[model samples]
Target: MRKIAIAVSLSIFIAFLIATAFLIHPFGYPPSEMDDYIIENTQSETGANNAVTAVVFDYRGFDTLGEATILFTAVTGVVMLFRAKKKREK
Candidate 1:
């Protein structure tokens, strides 16, 4: 019974994957609306001359900030741990 259930689940998942593969857009043709919009409006929207800078610091500002915060926290934790161990050894 358990084997039959697992087989049925796998077959259903395989059918779903095949169906999805057919429904997706063909290879080499990407959806370009977002990229087009960004390129066209980067200067006007953010007045930034660099598109890469605009995307990183403007469009993804909060995400970048969160990453920076996590990185800073990790470094601080490591430094604190090392400093404490050094002090204990002395």
Candidate 2:
């Protein structure tokens, strides 16, 4: 019964992932209006010479902040784990 339940849950999760994956756009073909708008207005709106910088710092500032936070958290977690392991060994 436990094996059957685990199998059913795994199957359902995989099916859900496949359904969402199919809805995603094909690679390198994202021809959207937002791309044109960003290219045209990046210098004027954000005053950043580089479009990538403009997008990261101006448009997606909060997103970049969140990503930085996550990276810091992961590094801290790894350091803590290593420290604990070293203490145990000693």
Candidate 3:
């Protein structure tokens, strides 16, 4: 019974993944409106020579900061989990 249930669940998950893969847009297409707007304005608006840097540091500053915070927390949690606990000898 357990094996049957596992097989059914795995089959459903795989089907969903296949359906999603087919729904995605094809590659090498023209940029979306938002992307075009960002590329056009990045240099003049942000005063950055590199558009990628301008987008990361100026346009998406808060979003990038949140990502950094999340990454730092994850690393700290992993480090704490693996750190050796000192034994107190009586």
Which candidate wins on lDDT? 1
**Candidate 3 clashing pairs?**
none
lDDT of each prediction vs. the true structure?
0.95, 0.92, 0.85
lDDT of 2 by residue, 1-90 (tens): 999999999999999999888877886777689978999999889888899989888888999999999999999999999999999998
What is the total number of backbone clashes in candidate 2? 0
lDDT of 3 by residue, 1-90 (tens): 999999999999999999987777766774589879888888778888788888888888999999999999999988776664433322
Which stretches of candidate 3 lie above 4 Å from their native place? 78-84, 87-90
- Between candidates 2 and 3, which one is better according to TM-score? 3
Model 1: CA > 4 A from native = 1-28
lDDT of 1 at 13: 100
Report model 3's TM-score to 2 decimal places: 0.72
Clashing residue pairs in candidate 2 (N, C-alpha, C atoms within 3 angstroms): none
Arranged by TM-score, best first: 3, 2, 1
Candidate 1 Cα RMSD after full superposition onto the native fold (Å): 4.8
